[model samples]
Target: MDPARASIDLATKIANAVSTVSAQPWEILTERNPDGGRTFEAADIARLQQIRSEYATLSMRGNVFCFREAFDYPGFSINEYCRDLHPNPVGESINLKIQAWSESHGIWIPGISEHCHDIAAFLHPEAGEDRFIAVAKCLSVDWYLNDSIGREWAPTMSPAGQANAMALREHIVEISRAMKVAPDAPLIDKACVEMLLEMQALSGHPTWFSRFLEMWIGHVQRSCGNINAENLGQVPDVFTYLQNSPHQSGLYYTLAHFEFSRDEYLDWSTLTEYCLASDVRNLCWLCALIGGLSNDLISFEKEFVTHQSQSNFVVVLMLNYPALTLGEVVEAIMMILRDLMEHFVTLSGALKNRCAGRHGTPAFRATGIFVQAVEWGIMTTWVWQTRSQRYQHARSIFRETQQG
Candidate 1:
């Protein structure tokens, strides 16, 4: 009757339930084409390289503008943010992986290197240059802080590193509050602070920006805790794992970024009620689960081999269903993903029907746009996962780590 034992029992029950369901091969449910169904054309190779170069330039600018003096680690350089922080035995940079994935998926835009711009332009072609640049910077800093810095340093963080992270958390809260009041205020020395100000200035609704900041804060906090749990070798039960996976998956920020990108269509004052409504929350949560679970499914082998499975759903399932093979657990996850997608489609239709009479209103239009963005995100993520070298090289990296 101890707490850990109870969790294990609950997880076993859940895993048994999952094993009862038959899973089909994963297929795309949304009709929307990823990158407009464009494959990498031979003639486009040069242009794609040029686009990657531009993003590298932007990344360098981000490192200098945002991270230069942000963390107090000895010998810390902002240049580190510009490099691939993820373990890569192939020596390919993160930017290179992004470029390759984007190009092959045909998501590559000639002038727009950032995915935010692609979503924004898809929703509103009239979205201007300044807004594009601002969103790009927002994404850059978000990646630098969470993916690059947090992933690289959190696991083995010394007392000094923990202090640095805590300081950043405090600074982010202060700046988020300050930006809500004076969005155009002078830039703070911190990269995240400046990006928030830009996003707030361009955001369609005050509440949306506030919600976005809140989600980001939660993500940072949850990521730290999850990493600590992993360090301690504590495997959470299925329910607890589900509760935390979505936040750590970074899908909350993805949803927020989608909203931020289509700011011109949103009228937060009119949409505020809907934003708080359960239907809308359900839509967002479903999107996050789909994304988070798909990531866990694809990265399962990597994490399992690396012994970093403490935070992975697949790992939790394996622990509960000790007799189940990895292949069986994967199929179970796929089944769960398919069910979530079906639910999303049904709920999205209902939500759209609820707004049928107000088609011309900002709220109605925004709802439609938001639903489309969610569909796009889901399809794009699945397609990218299938083709991305980022997830494909995990075994090679693990082997190299062992050899070293």
Candidate 2:
């Protein structure tokens, strides 16, 4: 809570109040005003609601895009979401009015349908077609949607959020019990809830919902010039063995690196399913394949040992149950990487079994260590790049720990 954030929070109520609601609301804006007043433009509202489906709308591409990826598409339109809520299949005069209103309000005015101009004059009276679109695009719909999703505001309030919220209330109750009083605030403030309810129509409320779009776009361009390697912190207390035994620390760290990378692969697959490849072909392709080379691995031969080479598909899945939670890609690659590591570990044990010159494959293990450190270095970069909004301090700490 720095001065800037403090100041923003202090006057947030006024700032929030100034934001305008959509021009698209027919019954609400036309039939009824923002205040509790009423409007009876039932005919007009019905028409707009009908065509709402066909109009271009704003929405996140998918849930995957929610936490990762950046949205670069510029124009803002509600065509997508409207249809979901209300499909305006017929083109009527009021349909045209919807278009005119969109144009006047800088909304990406949809093409006029047969339903045009019943309620010719509008209340807000948009400036013109282009300006209306500009205004609509300029709306902070992205921020609003993202904030709602992240806060788990509406969705959370329903069941999941409420469950956690109840626990939270219990804590509050404890504090209250200490003082003795119960809260009287409405379950959720109406004004706050309105933002989410407003977005209920979209395919994904924050469609093309790249919350980290700005930072990721910048990172991909290398505008920030890749700072991953320069950010590996010393092995933390949790990995004390790695810190004390730099060599061993490196090995386990390497294993962890492979694990994390495989996990991201799973996340990426889940994302593809949620947004990009929602078709049959993509699903099949996703389901098929060697699962591809894991982004992180110590060695092929070492990993092969742990992997049951002859296991059938079903057994493989069962053995890899914990790994699957990593999502998809990571799971597949990890199986491979595990097999390779096990093989190497076995080879080393065999030498010790025969009372050979060396009891351990120090060099093989050593290489694994280096790989982990490097992988960790890359992860440090990825987190800062992909999750910068949520993890602001990651980059700085990474730099401090890993910088040459």
Candidate 3:
């Protein structure tokens, strides 16, 4: 669901919860708590809600990062995202704010009492579909991540809940695979297409599956998504799904985790999350290779993730500076080609060993997400680099090029 509708629904749900309990006069507990300086005036709430709305509409950083992370898809980095989102001055720090927010609201969560709070706690009872979709969107997004603020969020689940979770996971996988096999649109009646073949089985009412499927596929094709490369059918609706897809893939986490702690590589053991993402990065590259697309960016990014480059990066200058002598191109080309070949070998081994067996096609299917995130980063750097040799000049040239 979009953000404004989602927020409205969330507000309603919280309000409803309050109203419901207040029917018997639910008490608003007045504990001796310190006031948080981050005041939420009516204006603040309006701005915040609008911010949420824009996130939904634009499929901004949160939507991209969260969604990509959820399905083991390759993802975008929030550090880089912060620089792009432009939501706050000085590129706001999410973890810092989360830490502050957590400290202030930690007590509000039910732990000692055994009844942890949910969004519904503060929501109105009469939540609308859109608002619930918004709140549920966050929950669903967060549900994919095992923790938020480094605290576990696996709310106590009854046997049924566990079953449902497993079932939904399987359902999504199956549906995604079926969609993969679907022929190019216009081959059959467009109305027969199901956005999610698995979920379609459950849409009992007059199904919107056809519309969803048609739009989603069209969206991917138009967006140059590597996921549907085999089909390349046009559908405009799929863009909607990008809003809630996981955001960070291995690159994002690697960069962000490193940002939060420079010793991320040394502490790689602690990087338990985004394991699938690490695998997905390689998988995405594999998909592009599988399709035999000779795009330099994908080929290079896959290589970077596989092995460290040993060659000097000045080779980039040779390619663009055509006025340079052949000696320069040859010398640099020799170095660049060697690195490329080595990277390719490393990539093949990485994917085949680290992912080819356990991760295979499903990971490949999620490549669209991986490509999307990388494209965003790539396009950003691409535009910036053309403007000036700002951040990536002295860097391996491949550092930004590798992921972009």
Candidate 4:
């Protein structure tokens, strides 16, 4: 056989083998549901159903700082970090506004805007009322976008599937021209295009806008690839998994949102250099790694319960380290997270000191904000993953296992 054909043959075999093995568990965990139904303990059903209400309460607890105490920067108050930002009456009004906007656009998400109050508040409390509205809109829109993209275009081995995938990819490319071309496409694509266009409008330079657009494009492709791989039951090795970390964790899009916090344009070279700096780059990688790993650990049981061959990092780790028990794999991931959190604090202070020295320079200010945003992303993600009803099954089933 030709080498290319031979390689393809091997890949297919590996995927088939993985799919077969994934269906049969070497170790038992959660109780599987019959008739291909969702695997839920009776109690878990109430938890999942009440997720929307549960989240509303959690949202009211407001934003809490995780690692802000380790560093201080001027113009950015330490007290600001310590202070709890309780949303005012305007927050409800903003939610209603966004909800109505989404409904008008044919993308209303029931309970999503209400539940994400804390998410928007946690991520961008620094924003003024109007900016917070924008952030809220983006978050609401994101829920719809993820559903449409993932549910509609997740890879399948069919002619129609290939066509849908290509169309979704092209939609991203043509999103900027969506208004001019097709005003009545799915609300998700239109909303996504509007959000990106708003970001581009706020970003004076095309370079940053272009960079963000590319990031979104890459995110869709990488995420869809993982979904496709999961469909095929192909598990990636650690390195390949880690390489997908940034995209999977949404680090780039998180940074793009942070960019809006800076009004001044950072030239390509300056931003690149700061991004490439030892502490900055390493801290980012660590954040992405921690986020990805933590998500896998949290969501593992959900996959098991659903009988979905999710390409979770813990499963990938198990594949590589065959002797490790499920408990051991959980522990290893937790240890890695603890270590990364420590490293994040240490690097945050070091980077803050360096930025303090160059405080007068634009680069330093930009770098400081970038680091702060990254810290927020990591810590906030932990809170969301742990508390969100989205992972109710994971928490109910695996929480004790993780603790042990």
Taking every candidate in turn, the Cα RMSD to the unseen true structure, in Å, is 17.7, 29.3, 26.8, 13.2
Off by over 4 Å in 1: 1-128, 151-153, 156-189, 224-233, 264-276, 302-309, 353-357, 394-404
lDDT of 3 at 146: 21
Q: Can you give the lDDT of residue 66 in candidate 4?
A: 25
lDDT score, candidate 4, position 15: 40
lDDT of 4 by residue, 266-356 (tens): 3446646766354565665666666666666665555433433345665555554444444444445554555556666678878877778
lDDT of 4 at 262: 44
Could you give candidate 2's per-residue lDDT for residues 245-300 as a string of tens digits?
Answer: 11111222122222222221112243244342222122211111111111111111
lDDT for 341 (candidate 2): 30
Q: lDDT per model, in order?
A: 0.51, 0.24, 0.27, 0.53
Best-to-worst ranking by TM-score? 4, 1, 3, 2
Off by over 4 Å in 2: 1-192, 201-404
| Candidate 3, superposed: residue stretches over 4 Å from native | 1-276, 286-341, 347-404
Give all TM-scores, in the order shown: 0.59, 0.17, 0.19, 0.67
Per-residue lDDT tens digits for candidate 1, residues 1-404, read 45345444544565454333212111211111111112223433343234334434533433211111211134433234223222112222334544454444333444334423232222222334555555555554554455323533454456677677667655655666665435554232245666677777887674877777767666665554225333444445555556566667767766777666667444545655665345665677778877777777655444443333345676566554445444345445655565566667678778777677677886777777777666666654544444344445322311211111
Query: Candidate 2 local accuracy as lDDT?
Result: 0.24
Model 4, stretches more than 4 Å misplaced? Answer: 1-92, 111-117, 148-170, 173-180, 225-230, 262-276, 307-309, 398-404
Better of 1 and 3 by lDDT: 1
Lowest summed lDDT window (length 10), candidate 1: 24-33
How much lDDT does candidate 3 score? 0.27
